[model samples]
Target: MPNALSESRACLPPPHPPEVAKGVILDARHALVHAEQGWMAIADVHFGYEARRRRAGALLPDWGMPQCERVLHELVRDHQPKRLILVGDIMDGSGTVEETLELLKRLTESVKIICVLGNHDRAGLKRGMSMIPSHREGEFLFEHGHLPLSDHEGVIVTGHEHPATHFRDGAGLRLKLPTMVQEQISAKTQRWILPAFSPWAAGGEYTSEHKRLQTWACGKGRVWRV
Candidate 1:
């Protein structure tokens, strides 16, 4: 007879990057997956952000597509999720529709990619997440966190705050990591702010106190509650 570990974890791929908690799978490297639903999500990709910044006279290195491809490919391979949900901020305000669309063409093959537009996604692209502000599936709502949630919703997941923090290592070195923020509004409602999937969106942090928030930080190839 199969033991409990084998039976339950047979569906679970591995013990790396993505860690599960409170019904959300933080896909090990900058993504989220709801295992039961087979839906994987990423947010704040801000594709072409560096190039856009360069146009405005900022001298940043060109390091967007490689990082994006690396993480997206890894998440897709590890989880093999059904839907690839891009919560928001798919592009910086500076990027072009052509630029964003062109870059998005290289993501996980055969996965349904859903994008929810953020404030920065106002470049007037006419398809997919470019025209939408939010996506609701059953009891769950996905949106960019630039606006307040309507009072009628129950469970909400958003990205736009670019939530992150600096973590200290045993060697006294501090490195910043993306974080998932869970906030409880009441006995019946909950909110989750997924961190930025793009490495370019680092340095954002929520310093104010939220009594009910439980954050899971991604660092050193793991997700741990902070």
Candidate 2:
């Protein structure tokens, strides 16, 4: 259950540098801002998901892409950061290649886009989008959490998990929410797993094998740390 204080704080616009970790700011938009580096990152956009499903006779409506674009544009407008990092899985690969490219074009016109390749991003590569293995700045290492990571000195931020948590209210209505997890691997190494930015993403439960990690649930444009 959410308290009045949490609800009210969630309603406010994102703080300029609301530090979640040492240098990370967890925005209400389900994105992370690297405060010192002037960069914003989002994961699992999963563009063209609706179109691909419709092609396969899923009877889905055309709403996901537009909604994602609107939210992305709003983030760019508000922060106007130096770069927008696509953490991974930007494309669905089933269909709608042209639409995804067009969106990238519009986004690049505003800020430089750094694409970190994920398993699903091969389609974008086939279509000629430049992507990198990982992005590193000061103390933050950004990568798609698909493969085993190498040893690094500082915080690791990854997006392939699409982390989520479930909640049941007093009325017995079950709610599944995308979540951000701050995983403390050791005293020296910490990892931040971001939620999927796409509304259609079926997120995986974020569980730790050793112990429980710090989690925050995001819903209705608001975020609550629980």
Candidate 3:
């Protein structure tokens, strides 16, 4: 198994051009290029995941709206992107209707919101929302990473791993650091797997030699510690 720091560095995909068209690749999650839209694309909010677990008697704490609000606020204020693309899993389940609505309301004033549906999102939770399977930006493709694509011709960005790397200190204490994975999908396609923005979420260890990462084509990508 690879150490956390080594694994993190190894998983990072090749760096985007200093200038991609008009946008700069901001971290591995989204691109902040100066375009007609001036947009930032993020994937997998998975809002209300804690609430869903609590409903199942999991006794999770209430960190839903506040956590999401903080991340969203920072991203908007820092980047000032006119458009925000939520790639998928905006809500954990149908049970978090009120919180989800409140979050949407708070975000309406600052930027335009675009959402795609993840596998966990059911029809009942997305009744009136316009959720798409995939979103295209210039030559980039954005999805939730739960589904597979037939081809990889452009940059593919997704979030589902909720990735974290485990590090051991001098005292032999293990710590899991959240991270982002970047790599090439094929000769012509690039892939970026983002760390979950939600504070109340859990993630898999990046160093684990599991089939899941292999399926996502994460074997030798570069990982960025968050």
User: What lDDT would each prediction earn against the true structure?
Assistant: 0.74, 0.82, 0.64
**lDDT minimum window of 10 residues, candidate 2:** 13-22
Tens digits of lDDT, candidate 2, 1-99: 999999998777443434676666777778898656899999999899998888889999899999999999999888788989998888877566777
Please name the candidate that would achieve the greatest lDDT relative to the true structure. 2
Clashing residue pairs in candidate 1, if any? Answer: 17-28, 18-28
Question: Which candidate would rank higher by lDDT, 1 or 2?
Answer: 2
Ranking the candidates on lDDT from highest down gives 2, 1, 3
Q: Which candidate number maximizes TM-score?
A: 2
TM-score winner, 2 or 3? 2
Work out candidate 2's RMSD over C-alphas: 3.7
Where does model 2 exceed 4 Å of error?
1-18, 123-127, 210-213
- For each candidate in turn, the TM-score is 0.82, 0.87, 0.73
Ranked by TM-score, the better of candidates 1 and 3 is 1
